[model samples]
Target: MATDNKTSAILHRDTRFVPKKVVGGKGSYLFLEDGTKFLDSTGGAAVSCLGHGNEQVNQMIKDQMDQVSYCHSAFFGTQVAEDLAQLLVDSTGGKLSKLFVVSSGSEAVEAALKLARQYFLELPTPQSQRTKFIARLPSYHGTTLGALGLGGHVQRREPFEPLLSRNTSHVSPCYAYRGKRDGESDADYVVRLAAELEAEFQRLGPETVCAFVAEPVVGAALGCVPAVPGYFRAMKDVCEKHGALFILDEIMSGMGRCGTLHAWEQEDVIPDIQTIGKGLGGGYAPVSGILIGDSIVQTMDKGTGVFRHGQTYQGHPVSCAAALAVQKTIQEQSLLDNVREMGAYLESQLKQRFENHPHVGDIRGKGLFWGLEFVKDKATKEPFDSEVRLSSLIQGKGLEPEYSVSLYGCSGTVDGIKGDHLVLAPPFVVSKTEIDLLVDTLEKVLKDVFASL
Candidate 1:
């Protein structure tokens, strides 16, 4: 493990902690410069869905490079870009009718927020009064200011809280593990959460609300937490009642990350505005996008006939080609089929290994994305002291030579500063054998970590 690289020139994510140098990567493993092979269980914060150095996606990037690498979206659009948008629309079966491509998950979320605001401005009556947004607490949208404003992740938003949008408010997240009362049934808990959302709308003056944005599955901020059944439908109904848009930020959980093209597919409601990335380009290129519903498309068509948003690198030909090829590869190879099958296997293995473990308080997730929440006192569900930095310690241990594995460790699951959890989201193409190795290595890592603590 490499740390405090005073001699290095690069300013990394954690300046004080320069991680091990990865020389190469393939399928579900990464090769470090020291000749150690690490099982990429979390896919580098769940970004490398297809794993590293996929040849078909790499070839598509090369082919697009030969043609035209970058072109400003203001002047012209490439056929590859057009085709990628069409593919996304088609994949939605016309439920979502248009696309606004961007370079990253944050950009996609920024685009979504802009589109929601503009969509309102373009409506027949032009509801300029609709200026407020409501998102779920403990949810993560992205890191850009606008996206960050919408996110309720306290730790990520702490420094930027002063700059965040006051118009965006947060409601209780549908986190049954923590929110559900001891004797509450799932349905009753959902109803209470829905009522809380409704109350937030009424308090905000329903006419002034623009949208209710949320993640179908909570990602890093809360560890792969999926909403309870019928929870989204209920929340969407409240939005419809208030004449507010129902937006879903699927940037970290979409593009087949949740065993479906869109995470909302599993739920009954399709979002009026959807943001996607991560698996969209499968780490081949930088890409993310906003999918628009017919109502918003019609509004824009009738009003400005244009979306009042533009980015220098939006819809780059090379990026679109890479995303399209990655998507096609997922379809052609039927990787999502493996996702479903191996998801069950991964879930079973995680539960079998962690369910009875003293520190593991909760096991949650859907598809291949799973998280194990650790507790200092299992019966009380008390978190380890944040000072101990349990999650960070677990993550750092994972990178050690003895562990030689990668897992996503996160804290503050209980109020953005109290609980701790770790996630395992392998590539869609991962096999049962790889899943076994990942879980086994993680179990070993946990043993060593807890013993030290």
Candidate 2:
């Protein structure tokens, strides 16, 4: 067991905190070497949908290792990889017909961007001028340069701004809590957002744009904010009018995180290119991929007949086997049903607890994913000062021995540098008892933190 006093070789996110070493985990709880158990509410940034120490997934990984763990996709494709890809394709009802597997969410977004650009280039008309992409403000795509440029999270991109690409632009996100006007109806708000997108396309010259990228439900950067009704269809219409592909970044909200198997399913509009990760492998392995629509697939088939981008571990046998097992388990256990039922319960409990809290500006989300936004004045929806670090305090207090609950906290929700919010995404296997405990512990943590302030 690693002692707390020992100097760590791994460079953690914050050197000051140096998080506790987790020794083991099962279901919705993680255990420390000292026997302290933490109820995992955020699932390590919403990745472990099936929870920890899943015997079935573990056995599958081991079994795959015994046969063959590593194989080059170019040299040979494993049956597991093909099976997983086919399953993902079928899950989309043939909407997204092809899969380009990768090792992380960033890689998936990178692949999507490259594929979009290549699609335009490969077309018979050859739109060589279409080199620009339009994303949304307060959205997070990933950390890599191309993906980072495609995102509009101001804080995360500030330090690397010089190195980021200039081909991408951003528009206001469909955040009803703030973006919606005082008396505006949902349809009006959507129309306004669509107008902004259309204006952006015109500003950039429609023929020069390759794609419009967005998240079906904004994650950390905006605290689980879902678009208003008809928001997606409106944006898709604008993209269609401008002849640009519509790409949905489901890296954090897809794969049953938001009730449905795909977040876009709830929106009633399909994306031309979709990227999925995090929950794909349920934290059993690092896996992500780009799902290509029929048009893009056909374009590539008729042109170069190959995607230019490739990763060394693009289709590792073990990762694919683990992902296949994870997906199969979700389907076999009918976890989506549980997610919906439990998610409704969780949402009700959260509203009942924080509805009147002075610091809680909003509580919003769908399925098992939820976010609690903090503010100084609920009436004005004024966020707390950045220095207050309210979300971090709540996160730290929740992890203390007294609470022993884990929550995901993020900053810059308001404008990429000022807002604070906490996310709760328990595993699909989470029970009602666990949900109650999670809320109770969080209530105590909130009371304790606020009392000190």
Candidate 3:
């Protein structure tokens, strides 16, 4: 995978190691400059939903560029952006009235936070005291300061702690693998989590909280863990009781990636603010946004009629157009049904391959988003030493000629420093043969790595 780093001007995530070079991609695979091909199993942090070189998405972007590439959203309105927002609202049956588009998932969270605070301020009674936010620990909202502050991944947030806002606090997430103690039923765990959330609000003075933020299906921080039954409902109940808006960050797990248009659709609760990205634009452009429920949208309409926040690229025409085309493609092609069928097939194949494997701790996810948490001892669920870098090893090996695969890998799944996980979020347009190739390659990769270990 070595390309070159000495002369590079880009400051990549790792300067110590140079990565492979790619010349082009089409469908479910990427072609290296030298023509070495690799299946894109994780889609570069799960962003490329429609897959590489999607003609419809590309055509839409090009057409949008031909029309108007960069119209400052502040002074003008773009029909493409408006149409995108309308599509999103209609997808939710208009339960959510508005969406504020941003350039990335981080920006969406930032906007949601600001809007939530403003929602309280615009209320008739004006609860300006509602300034705090509660998010789950071992969770990731985004990488920007406010989003990072709100995200509870300890190691990622530690270096920037002094610069982050102090108003956001954390509570335990609904990670059944580690969070559920012996003999704790799913119903019991939900109650316990709800109580903990209530306690956090009480300790912080419930009146001071503006929103409760969390992911419906936990991403990297917990390795594709979905909350237990009734979990979201319980958390939302706590938030409602505290007069705090409920916010769901579905950046990595929404937009038909989870076999549904919205991950919250399966949860049976509507979020007051829902942040979506990654799959939103299908890697056609830098994009993300927050869909606001009527409770907050109408409140602002009756009051300021303006959300006191704006980004230079907010509601960028090209990005919105890309997203709209991506969504339309998904709908027109019936990709959600494929996600369900393929998801079940992928799930079955995964369990059949790794369920009995000693090193695979858990296989968790829904639809196309799945993850394998590596453990040293499955019985005790003890994680490998962080120094082993097992997840990255699996990822690196997966990309080698022998395997020819790409996956999203991360460590510190347990307490931000003690666990390892490999994510498998293939493009929504993947086919059965591609799924077979992915699983077969993964099995060989896992077996090969475990042998050396």
Candidate 4:
């Protein structure tokens, strides 16, 4: 069992005071120590797609435990792991090169980085091959050292700047709302962004860059923003021309969150290495992994006959069982269909309620994920003063009385330190009534906070 230390020794992300203790969870709500239930709008950073107390997922875990909780992969293989891998490969149309599992998104990312480097090494381009990683500014991959370096969240990287990788660099994210010129067409804006990526590749010498990493739908960073039309295809073309790998961090945007099994399917491009998590196990277990493209995997299979990387928990039996159940549930129930239907309803509801609101700057998202940008002036799209902590205030307001909402606060949408946004990612199984409640509560909370401002 874990032992409790002194409050100061806890070393929480925020040290001002203690956070509320969660005692239990049930049906899309989290119960706190004092018995207050929060609506769970953010689904714990968009992880709990199945929501709290999903019986099927829980039963799958229990069954796996009853059979065999774990066994070292070095000595033996588990059917659960093999089946899950087969499921994933089948879902991707048998095009995936390999599936490397890990315990978390960060681990998945670390593996991908090492795998990319290894791929180059095996191809004899180990020396002249690209060694640099190019990701967009304001994007986040994960929190570990390698993943952290790949991420561009300034605030998160500030304290760890000295320890981060110098091999990684940032470029502009294809955020049309903020990135588009005053009168630039969407197509022109995509071209401009593509040009920026090309320039970066040229600047770094294309052969020296290992991969171009991006979140197909910018998650956590720019608030579920999908690229403008032709943006991804153009970027993929550029990467192909440069002989660089395209790695996508879909930890928050894939697995039907964007109305497709893989978000890349909607973008008309395929990543050489795709990192997925959160929805993979639907928060039933801690699991994330990399789905490799045919070329990279084939190169390694033929050259080394073994991957040079792995984790202790790689292909964990219990985690794989839970994830397999989650995947099966999504497929058997056709949850992606619901994601599209309910996503349209949620988008329409948000637009109807906030599109013309005085202080609401933007409402954007895909499927069940969404974000609301708060601003002081709608005409100028000037965000609220960060000092006011408008996002926090709205979040606090929503977690009152009977409704509990987790608002994901984001800054730097306007710059690296000035804007604020609230992300809402409810469960995939959410009903119209529940969505209405979320919309109503969010509307009320925003209004109350705006009035206070």
lDDT of 3 by residue, 108-206 (tens): 999999999999989999999988999988889999999999999987998999999999999999998889989999999999999999999999999
Candidate 2 C-alpha lDDT tens digits along 37-114:
889999989999999999999999999999999988888988899999999999999999988888899999999999
lDDT of 3 at 260: 99
> lDDT of all the models against the reference?
0.90, 0.92, 0.91, 0.85
lDDT of 4: 0.85
**What CA RMSD would candidate 3 show?**
1.0
Q: Judged by lDDT relative to the true structure, which candidate is superior, 2 or 4?
A: 2
Q: For this target, which candidate reaches the highest lDDT against the unseen true structure?
A: 2
For candidate 1, what is the lDDT? 0.90
Candidate 2 worst ten-residue window by lDDT: 1-10
Candidate 3 is scored at a TM of 0.98
Q: Where in model 2 is the C-alpha error above 4 Å?
A: 1-6
| Predicted structure 1, TM vs. truth | 0.98
Q: How well is each residue in 331-448 modelled by candidate 4, as lDDT tens digits?
A: 8888889889988999999999999998888888899888888788888888877788776677667766544677777776676567888788887887888889888988777777
Runs in model 3 lying further than 4 Å from the true structure? none
Give per-residue lDDT, candidate 4, residue 188. 93
Candidate with the larger TM-score of 3 and 4? 3
Ranking by lDDT: 2, 3, 1, 4
> Per-residue CA lDDT of candidate 1, range 35-151, in tens?
998888888878888988898898989999999999899999999999999999999999999888889999998888888889889988899999999998888888999989998
